[model samples]
Target: MNAILIYLLKVIAIQAVFYLIYTLIFHKSGRHSINRFYLIFTLAIGFLIPFMSIPKFQSYEPYLEVDKPIWYELSDLAEFSNTEAELIPVERINQSDFTTELIVAGISLISLLFLMKLIYSHFELIRLKRQSKEISKNGHRIYCSQIESPFSYFKSIFIPKSLLDSTSFDTIMEHELVHVKKLHSIDRVLMEVILSIFWFNPLLYLFRNRLIETHEFQADAEVIALQQDPIAYQEILFQQINAQKVISSANYFKLNTIKTRIKMMNKNQKLSKWHYLFILPLMVFLIFSFSSREGEEFVAPLKNDVSDVFDYVVNLSDSYTPSIFPLKDAEGVKLTASFGKRIHPILQVERMHEGIDLKTYKGNPVLATADGIVVEAGIINEISWGKIIRISHNGIFETVYAHLSDIEVKSGDKVKRGDIIGKAGTTGESTGPHLHYEVKELNKGFLNPVDFINDFDFKRYTSIEKKDIIKLGKPNQKLKVVIDPGHGGRDQGIVSSNLSESEIALMVANQVFENFKSSDEVEITLTRDKDELLSLKDRVSKSEGADLFISLHMELHEDEEEEMMTAIYNYQSEHSAASQYFGELLSKEFEEINRKFKVGYTEGNYVLKNAMSPAVLYNIGYFSNSESERYLNSEKGMKEIAQELSDAIMASKY
Candidate 1:
């Protein structure tokens, strides 16, 4: 669900850029069909591109962890322990409605209502068509009704009685005929669905307005091109300026103000094809703008800086970058303590302080440090903190806020940095009511929260160098492979006395990842390398660019001696022959590598079945069988399995 919202947002952003390009560059310069094609292409690409990942090849080099880095506390004399001290949940007297779940649920519910309205509109149009008297006029189907207004729905045209006898009927018919033959209703339905799905994006609404205008311009220009009396058509359209509005698909002649239609009709100039080429640069800009964060070698700008900040703070009303104080509408917040060694206030023992504590009101609202996805949220009895929220800015950077009076986000919730994540209070190993803030860069050093805030840089970065861009700008010559490791986090698959599905799958996937990472022949990716539970939506969204996909898993059964492995594929896949061929190759590899194991073919696993690429689900030996379980967990078993799979992939002719 979180992935769906993120994808929608990415698409909305891309669509906004494309819409701007069309309005400022191509809309006025080219002929109707040319501009129409551009608009459609922009819409189509915007909707699809978020699913397509830009290639990123980071050198998977090793790094050593510093025992004591810049941000390391002086109080770490005590060793870390898995068992945390019993902690109390923080108490907040009054809480506000600033919560992530409510906001997401509200948006989703509203979109559903919008969908219902769209369905109603289509059905209402159909009901009207069924009740109306039908007659054939000039090789078109016309439905005569008592409606005060006239409009076309799909291939059927509905006309009111007042217009049937009027002299303007032929001109209106000419307009409606163009709409029907050109299949404008299909465009209307598509636009309606797009709007329904992305109703939150104001840019889409603006784009819709432009699209409606373009449709009218095309139809009006066609009617006038016949050398019919243009004056008569203008008079007919404006005469119904106060036309009764009705629930229908768009592009009505009388519904909107007649000024735009009349103005377009009055124009008399031919545009040059040269203007359309301007789109090339804008497309490049859009790609670079988004690719910065996802590509390797690109240092992320401070999230919500400059234009991103403009979008949230100035325009959309949110905050990020942890630039501001956590307390909202507060003045002169003083730092009570620094992040370092401190005497445990209550315990009377020395300890390293990993986080900075700030002096504030007991129930003051606590904001997020940056724009990120909530990785962890809730009260933890196993930790010193009562309620903690951890958010990951990218995959590499994370911020943790501990000892909160209340938590407003859950795992997988995307949040802006300044949004009130909770109320600050004393909870779990706290001396007093305050907020504990920490910043950690995975595999790097943790930085002082204060220093990180003050020294935050907003430089934009990208990995697509000139030559790389030129290569990517052309058609692909490299193979793209995505590997999905089945089950993770709380959704850990098939657990038994000794073997864990998620663990074994990840171990094998990691080896496969290492095998492919060393080679430049294929661009390899994993749906997950760690135990972060991803929804089916999230998995499918990231699997868009794969030429071949493999999902790893281990399933247990009732029989203890059942040790044979099975490779599953999408029986309904478009490339079924290719999948079958690869499945056979995998069976052959397993048989040749280890005679102790046998391979079989199966069909219809969800992850495999839904993959767009030729994908398979490779289930390792069942943990249900004790002998197989011991063998699967052995280091030798893991290496042999990984080698065989890698070899099979390399040996594939496809």
Candidate 2:
């Protein structure tokens, strides 16, 4: 279910409960003021209750003293828990699918139409006021027009020209004056606007109808009280019952609810104030059912000496500051998008881009811009940022890294500047591989990340020259190798008219797996054997305890002549030397088979950087080249490529 849809449902449910209460208990009450207030108050509170949050108690085992229970108030606990005391503003996302988005668009369209209608209604009133002859009476401007009925909007009362000379003219003025003096037109307009937005909810229409009925009842009661003749006022209302009236943003002297108005007017007994006491429990029920509750960890109980705990409480230091660029490699930094308002590339709308995009290769390391505590490091509700990390620094500044393919740190973890937190990739609502970086201050909202970043110091954090090789097994143990076929299931990476990158990668990866499956010296594991959308994290996890991890992929190049077998290794990894060695051997094997081959290094590439062993991502061929595509599709080409790659992997071990 969509988050927006869920929120709408919650609001609708709350409104329904309020409606039920009104219809059952308060609708028939003679107290019109109380009924009117209940309807209007509930109408507003129904929409607000979902956003409301309350605090809840949670037991903390760390501070629990079983023998002597010590009660610590929330004020006292704030000094002990620094993060809990401070408020961090996190962006709330309403995750919606295509169908949900379409539904919301439709709803907005309908609401816009209703708003237009309301505007037109007011325009009609303004036009009528201009055309009519204004006659001043009782310090009020009365617009006498050639109409069948009378109505009031603001201080302007519109009456039929025939009634201005008739005996019932004064009586008609009295009813409409009540609407003007009491500002019933404002209520009418307010309800109309509410109805326009929530027209889909039938109960809202009912609420509007009920409000109109109460307005008529109140006006009738006032008129009867002034005239001191209930019978004559009833007769006047009955006369207007059959008259056709213009339904603009005006309270009319019409009788849509004539029977109810008469009954309410005749009733002398008022409902006891004690009957309203039921609302207290109802409000409590709504708060508990709909309002959000955040767990507050209880650090103390009821009894014991807790003065020592307060004395030792130390505040969190806010001295750490960022010094280096988030990306370690200065050469790889390519600014694709900058912060601030711009036409969104994907949505094609003028929206705020709160972060700066650093375009880098897939599987590049995303460093913490500053020494900070990891506030949030995981996948959120929306896939727009597939994996994100938010670090709070100096208790005032915060940095956010979004659209990552892999996350290395977890929430609450401490990190230093330039530390690898994740790998950048084309995850979420992205066009290609890049990192969306943001810088935020405590009071001031999102600031440009470029403002805080200094020149990248590549020498300070140079790539590891050598990596310790993990012991495979005993002297005669088989080498465990994990082969990952990139982009499966719904994720058809680098798609062409005839074939997808996933298909080509899988076909070649399967052939490599087949070659190693029968070998006594090697044991092979496929991250995904069939069509399935396996996450980058899942692919890296499967590489655990394996001697080597090889991710097979196919890519498209703009140039048709760019057809070559390429091997990419994570240069920053501790196993960089072994990965580079394997890539070199693989390049040589491809050369022996008379295939165009090249070996390169990348700071990005999720699987290569995060895999438990020496890893490499090998691009077999460019799908963009017609001849290369044909060769990749052919059975002979797959077998030959797989054989050479397997030969190199076996040779590289020596």
Candidate 3:
């Protein structure tokens, strides 16, 4: 809604600037046709320029980075919690709130009223056409009616019955004939429609009046082109000085601006064609200033966050390095698959095999191939390699052990070579129980695990090292989540007497975090633990390896007499399915607690747009509403809200 308001303001500014330029320099420049087109064209550019996105040019260079090694239907991983139930009813709010929504609605209503008036006048013209007497004069159709003055609507020229027999009838017919031949009614209708939509813009009214004057100028010029005496035309206009006004939708002949119109007719200074060339620079300025600028495109280096371990793996394969076999005394323990391009057994598609699959029975001890510190040891709720462990060895290389049943070592644990880090089993995307082992140098991609394995005969293709192994059992896999409390420090959002939006947002986020910080199945990380303002880009960057991104925010509705409902917005894109599914689950939980909730999709939110995981921006309530502010600040109310949201998030793991 704020984005919509900003766009409208931008359009108004552009139109206002153009209208000012038109009035100061081009109003009486004596080029009616060209000036007419300028007005309409500027109006169109006002609406279009804001949507343009000009990409900046820069030299392109490829960065060394690991690519995704697996692909799956991300939406299919979560079970949607929606059920066949009665529709939920939303609570009502005061309609008199001076909120952004109310302002937009008011503008729409006024525009609609203006549009209806225009439509009714058009229909009246149709009725007048049907009721008036028609006659042919000098290859033109004329309609005689009880109107106050002569006017032209499209192809029909209507004149007052009293003027049909007047001495200046021939001259009046000539003027109306010019309007019909030049399609002046089309310009009037176009301006009228623009006025109907933007009735609040004073500049539009100015443009409309100027355009009508331009139509009269064109018609008067055309009349003069037929060798009509200027003094005689002036006499005709003076005779209609007291004529009653006609409907705005029609081009009526009147003497309201007779003196100005007459001066424009006699004006001698013609607008140079070069004068229009100045508009090119103005157009370029608008394009550069209003349009979105796209930065140079480049690949970002992979972070050390293990959240994306499913996509890229680090492998090591130095023949000079002596590494453990990682499998101890297992029957049929043999090399089943080698690294490189091969058909994935479970996916049935040919893709790069980043790791070598070892044939080993379930519950077989899996040891660390080298002395290293455990970096990642967890399970992801996905279809790719599951129950994985990544070990960073001496800051030079890393090793990955996937498809394990039990992880014995937690992250940050230092272990020697031949220590039992896990047990072999098929946990993710495997046809049978086997160990998928990988190794890689730091900053490099995955290498063939077979190259780093010692005590393995390449010709026999079978290996086992049943010695010097330490065993421990402590399995762990927590759903990592990043909770972003919007606004902080200097960026205090929506200040009130009780609390600001930033304070309240952080309060609610902390409540949610406190509920799950001790849970084994869930892990929560707050983007900001204190009242420190974090940039939207920084917030998204900090949530790099998160499984879910939840941004907490509050709205303001000044003059609101009732509480505003909560809203959950999911990211809108190809990756939106998972976010939408999660939003549905969260909205239901909010509803269960008697909180009226609305679930929608948004594309303009920066945090949501950049999130690499299932993300939602949760608008808690309006801060301007006194009751909502109190509820948000209350400890008990915050606790209940946190409990419901946390429950929904915990349920999404399956």
Candidate 4:
């Protein structure tokens, strides 16, 4: 609302400035017809612009589902909990305020008009009372009488009985009558009202006065057109000027009126045809500005409240429970038939077929193999799999189903054994529509899902035992370290000469893992055991309570002068001391491999900034140096750098 108000104010200011320019260039210089038109048009624009402006509303929430606490709960506690909090109810305030404001504004406008009318009436009454005191003593005056009406058009200016012989009095009477017929006094009052509304607008006031002067100019022109001796009329204007003092609202026959009126009467110049040219463009611009629709765009209503829909799903899941029962094994289930080698689709190699192939028609319902909660169910546009669903069976064991047609369940939904969760489809890496399933022990690792299903009973499906998946060494005990590879699935981070940073990092991480694995007293866990991308933040977050964090990378230098050197970047505020110690130790270990391996430290790097534990980022080699670049691209060269990285991390004390 504030933004919209500011925009309307700007447009009004621009129009006002243009109006001022018109007044200065044309109206103030000399009398012209176009100037009169400009004056009227400018006043109309000032009155109408505010009414044309509209308000804007552009705020909405996005749809997202995740395991997290509510946002309000996470904000500052004192502010959110206070009873007297000044929270703006946007929806309620917008409707009520706009309607009430419009009503009040309408009433204010009507009251203003009535007040202006009263003020004009009062001033006219005061002028009339003053005029009645003076009487025509000269016999040359035809007639003189002051009537009691503030409106000049209704008031009669009588030619006295004795002043009839004077030709100047007759001419003056005719001129005053013209002013009365035109209602010039009423026009002056209207202009004053306009000036009051646009008090700060100098152009409006200028145009008002100019418009009145033009009215007189037009009336004088009519008098001259009569051909009744212009010099005699000029003299008549002078005699009538002092006969009555100029009323506040009077527009003609006032003090100093003879000087300008006589001068204009003497030099009568008709307006040229070309004088209207300037108005053509001004009219066009006004038509475009006033007639065009330039307000906020309308938005269509949504089918459902998205936030409410999400809440509904969450409530449904909270109330849901999965039913468990025993499963019956098929008769004549040969061991070899159940699990054996099969021809691979892409590799064309005879490898172990780890899972059973569930043959079903297209769109046939596929059920959850066990009582579990849905951990992932969504459409995937990856190169290998299209749509997939993975469920964690009590957080100990899990099953995955790929190449699904449609997923009926979302993450966090609990399911019972044999529940229809999806339909079969040939979504990704398939010869036909079939369900590709896999099961894994929570910590122990992958177990052929088919093996467990054959003897499993839905009612008797007990929780599996948790296994120590990745063994870690005792605290203060010498432990072998493994730096798991990052970005292997389909993402190859930062590549040079077709050699990816992901592949290089993986090679180095694996080599380091192997070097440490040879030590009996040391245990190792690679961040990733296979080619896959692990989120850097997630990995660092879990590395809390870990002995060491070794993030490997191949450096890309834009400057040729920056050569092959191992730089370690760490957060200065959080882990500065630990990072420095780790860097010094790593540098010593790398020195044995090659003297060119130097340690560079940076406190501004993101990975180390929030790390609660000691962390080190190793830039194994530089792309700018041809020799180091070549070595980094090869398996053998990577192994050597990896060996140094492993020895450095293992040598560091927590």
Relative to the true structure, candidate 2 reaches a TM of 0.48
Question: Of the pair 1 and 3, which is ahead by lDDT?
Answer: 3
Candidates' C-alpha lDDT: 0.65, 0.71, 0.69, 0.52
| Models sorted by lDDT, best on top | 2, 3, 1, 4
Q: What lDDT would candidate 4 get against the real structure?
A: 0.52
Model 3, C-alpha of 270: deviation from truth (Å): 1.3
Better of 3 and 4 by TM-score: 3
lDDT winner among the candidates?
A: 2
TM-score of each: 0.43, 0.48, 0.43, 0.39
Writing each residue's lDDT as its tens digit, candidate 3 over 1-654 gives 433445567778888888888888888888878887888899878876665545445653322222232432121111111121111112224423267557778988999999999999989888988999999887888899888899888898899999988998988888888888889888889888888987877777877787888888888888877865888888889999889766887888874789998898788788886787878898898878775333332122334886333222222112113265778654467455566764333222334767776766899999888766676677743357678887765444578788899999886676677889999998865546778888876435678776665455444211011011211111366888888988899988777677787887788788888898788888889999999988878899876767788888776543365353433343335456556556666777887877766454444456777787768877677666778878887887678778887987876665
Angstrom error at residue 459, model 1: 39
Instruction: Give lDDT tens digits, candidate 1, residues 1-654.
Output: 334455567778898888877777666552777777777788877765543334355742222112323321121211111111111123233433357658867987998999999999878888988899888888888889898767787788888877888888888888877788788778778888878966877876776677766777788889888746789888888777777857646457675747867876877775788877877887777765543243322222435447544442222222333444455634434344455554332221234656566656688888876676675677754236778887766443568787788888887676776788888887765545678788766435466676555322212111112123212111444567777888899987777676578888888888888887867665678899898899977886666866778878775544466676755455346754456456656777887866433222223445665777777767677776788888788878888888888877765633
Off by over 4 Å in 4: 1-38, 46-170, 241-247, 282-483, 487-503, 506-524, 527-654
Poorest 10 consecutive residues of model 1 by lDDT? Answer: 78-87
> Candidate 4, which ten residues in sequence have the lowest lDDT sum?
76-85
What value does the lDDT take at residue 201 in candidate 3?
Answer: 70
Which residue pairs in model 3 clash with each other? Answer: 314-440, 315-439, 315-440, 316-439, 316-440, 488-533
Measured by TM-score, the strongest candidate is 2
